[model samples]
Target: MSEASIKRAALYRMVTPEHICPFGLKSRDLLRREGYAVEDHRLRSRAETDAFMAEQQVKTTPQTFIAGERVGGYDDLRRHFGKPVPDPKATSYQPVVAVFGMALAMALAGSWASLGDVLTLRTAEWFVAFSMCILALLKLQDLESFSNMFLGYDLLAQRWVRYAYLYPFGEGLAGVLMAAGALTWISAPVAACIGTIGAISVINAVYVERRALKCACVGGGSKVPLGFVSLTENVMMVAMAGWMAFRTWA
Candidate 1:
């Protein structure tokens, strides 16, 4: 679009003594990014802000007008530009990604510090252990929420609701024991039982039932989808348990 034909946007945002409205700034930036010439209007006080809103017959500040037409707020501007707006209620894999990323980093750091190597069998073990610990921490943050989500797929949790509540603690304990390379007898059994039950649950939910659902792997509040990642977690635990048991016997 030519400069003359480019849309002109008017923005009114609060710049009061106590606070500067962040959305107002965002609106102005968004307008500029969309090739709009922004006419920035700052309301310096609560009273002034209120007056502008009242005069405009709008409920919120950071109001935008483009080419003499009211274009609503920041979210509206995004929609106008055909950009995907973030939804607060939406499910996402961000929590699981962050936890797993951190676990991998910690595993590498620990391996380098102790064994002077980052790629070794011990590093793999530490990675799984740390992942378990981190995942457990997330679930323990809101056990009730975790249990609710977990019961949707976990056979044991569905049959015995208390298992859902105890799941985090069990995972945490097993992780710690495995990390310490101590009490393999206890940790091995615990890991095996939970992993077996979890794999069965995931297989049934994702394949047999063909139910699309959110994963409780990160926590109850997460939007992480249930599927391959959940299955992998169970498989990892099962493998770890078997490894520990073999080491014990050897």
Candidate 2:
């Protein structure tokens, strides 16, 4: 086993029915109601848990610590316990702009494609599979966030990863729809779906900005402030959406 394995080894599952995150205590209570004994704070900290593992002789690989510091396992748990880490909400705004810009660029790409020779039926099918694939990849990176993206309200603040996954697939599908629209004038359905997705992205972006929360678009691009570049990108997406609508009907 690699050293990184030991860093977080066995930590993810250390929580017992009783020891659940306070944020998820309702579930713990429900589990108790269902008759499983749970601890409220069975595994308090990484040091505590690591000590338990060592005592139990749980074999784990060493961890490669660049800083040679033991970042507490159960960061999720810590966050739930209200320990202060960098506020995800305080991330740089630049990432927010970059993410939106990517979305807008995708929208334009799809609009331009709609004017191309791709078949509408083929494009729609493509859009579905392709978008789902992107979603899948995003989910692969972080399933909890993806779950929250579709269902909303992740208590863990996993939204940033979800946003990253949704952006590319959402925009890519929009572009594919545009291509199909030009060929068969039947890509409207796909365009509509893409538009709906775009609207959602816009909503997320607006909400982040309105809340004055920094963008958590970590995997999507560089960490920076939301700025003019982002605004320009969104304008392009608007253009793409408009172009798709026109070409699909025209």
RMSD of each: 3.7, 14.9
TM-score, cand. 1: 0.79
Positional deviation of residue 45's Cα in model 2 after best superposition, in angstroms: 26
Candidate 1: list runs displaced more than 4 Å: 1-54, 59-61, 65-69, 80-82, 87-91
Tens-digit lDDT track for model 1 on 4-71? 78678889888988999999999988888877888999999989988988999988988888778898
| Candidate 2 runs further than 4 Å off | 1-90, 93-144, 149-171, 177-188, 194-239
In lDDT terms, which candidate is top? 1
What lDDT does each candidate get? 0.89, 0.41
lDDT of 2: 0.41
lDDT at 38, model 2? 40
Count backbone overlaps in model 1.
0
Model 1 / residue 39 / CA error / Å:
7.0
